[model samples]
Target: MDAAWLNPEEWTCSEGVQEVLLESRKSSTRLTYLAKWTRFSRWASERGISPLRSSIEAVLDYLLHLRNQGLAYSSIRVHLAAISAFHLLIQGQMVFSHDMMVRFLKGLERLFPQDLLKDFLYKREKGELLIQKSKRLKNNLLKQMQLSVSKDGFVHFGDTVMLLSPENNKSPTENYPAACGNLTLAVNPDDITVHTSESLQVPCGLSAVKSVNPVGRNAFRILSVEGNSMGEPIRFGQNFGLGATGGFTDQMLYLASDHKSFMRFAKKSYLQQVFLTDELSYLTCWQATFLDPQLRLEYEGFPVPANTKVLITHCHTNRGLAVPRNYWIRSYFGKEYEVICHTYLDSHKAEEDKNYWIIVTANPSDDGITMFDRPKPPSEETREREKNELYAGT
Candidate 1:
């Protein structure tokens, strides 16, 4: 062994190796080779050996170490190349014999399926080619589309057309052909409808709501309720303002467009179905009822089969303060009842009063029905403010 080659000072860092490589190859290729060299240098340094003068026996030892560490066969081959290159540069002789290289490559072929490796290589090469082609095409297209402005402040493209202003030059409906064989169009937000109700038909000016274009349309209405049951934050008379159109399906909940009624299929509550009974003929009209999967008629208190048609409704989770007796009477008598007029007087507020009116129709008759109502009020400060500002100003 030559003592000069074993000198630590003579050996270089992987970065230095890359600097030398840059003189002969492209920067990208040099960087890749440098990465491999760095790994080899680290491995040799850990073993107290000079990487540039490492012997064939040392190479075998490094390969065994890599295998013991669970490195893949392909990675080991890459390491072998780096080690061989380092030794050749320093010792002026080849470190790996042709037979050894062949054996190493054969081992890699066995460890990784040939089909998998071939596909990986094919995709890697194809990606590079595609990127290069895309760059060239983009440049050509940009050059062809470039326009020049004249003394009249009009943009001209080879005398085809004159652009008046920046806004006029850009067409709102221009369609660019895509590789997927579809024309991608530009849309104007002002030309489409974003929000509307089920009762009020979406205007024709907003008919392009379904179009898939930049600014084309997003015309679907959606309402998201945060409670487990339909009754909490949304009360009987509350209006759930529709913000968009066309997104609702059947059974989807909504406030009445007229803002007077809360409509939902009766029997939609699981609690009502679980408690239906025979003796209780008149179910609560405020609570909805429905037939369960077992073909059993169900209501708030009695899930029974008494050969009776029951009128079911929905209840808010807060539990109404007054189970209006009229609600039960209409359910048993099968007659419509007017919710003449009701008032919500918050005890917390002395001067403010809010009232609501409703008309309900119920069917089926039995007995033992209960109704309760509690009066709640807003703050006195709020009432005073409303009187001074809103009502007084009006």
Candidate 2:
């Protein structure tokens, strides 16, 4: 707004000072740009937009307005140059020289190849194009948390109930593991305790993992199947059985394949009797392993922490357990998504992938060892007792 910066009186300062000042005021076209700056200022002031300190959105809106008024592309650049010079003189920042502004101009060039203004006016008048201002909002950046599970933690065999949590960007009340509006990984119980017999199905997909409506008690039990079965602590990289611990009938989850050549995408999961000495029982065994190198280095062979993301690998198929978020089906428990076992190894992106599952331990007790706890060394009496027990076994 100050024309004093444009025109100057005879300088009586030192020779070097006058020379530097003259160099700074070397723009001969400053007088021509004055009218452009005045027009922008008037337009901005009328629309409640500050000409001195305005956002990128405001600048974009002004450009759109210029295009709508049938201004030539060269004329628009001249106006921008004037605005840039005005901002540099007043605010000490060349706004149009920003990377975003440069990219925007390039994008406009590409989008409108020939007669940018004329084409824009034609399209806009014909109702084929419309420029809508985007509302300014905060970015919802997902945060990551790291934790470790120890041997004596709450992840016990056939006892501890847990929920598979997914990262949610929703509100705090209905977030991860609390699937109020979204699908939750659950098994449909054949026998309904609360509902009458007529309402229930006799032999539904048992232990079948489905992304069903969350019934609050949708949780699974982790059972150790490798060494010291059922009663011992479940460890990472060790074989285990996952059972739907929700309703009247608890079934062990396993991957079932139909001898199809396209088994990678076709292998569906089911719940059945895993402890029985049948050929299909081996499919029930699965292993939990870390997908991250840092996590594996620190927590490998250790008990997997509850509410932490880990890879669930099926022992029989040697494929990772996955829930295809796109595949939806109508189940006895309403609309549900399908779960399958497939090794995501064709691409190097498998190193950090969707195969990761969050296991959230339910009702964690105070006495149970947690991921934060450090293991204490055994005393002399404990060592003597262990030696005596070994000697007796021998």
> Considering every candidate listed, which one attains the maximal lDDT?
2
Poorest 10 consecutive residues by lDDT, candidate 1: 159-168
Q: Model 1, 70-183: lDDT tens per residue? A: 676656666766555446543444555545556755765676675446655765676534444444323321222211112222111121111000111223344111011111
Model 2 residue 316 CA deviation (Å) reads 1.2
Q: Score residue 22 of candidate 1 by CA lDDT.
A: 37
Best by TM-score: 2
Model 2 weakest lDDT span, ten residues long: 133-142
Off by over 4 Å in 2: 1-154, 168-183, 188-217, 227-231, 249-280, 293-299, 345-347, 351-353, 363-394
Give RMSD (Å) of candidate 2 vs. truth. Answer: 25.5
Give per-model TM-scores. 0.25, 0.39
Global lDDT of model 1: 0.32
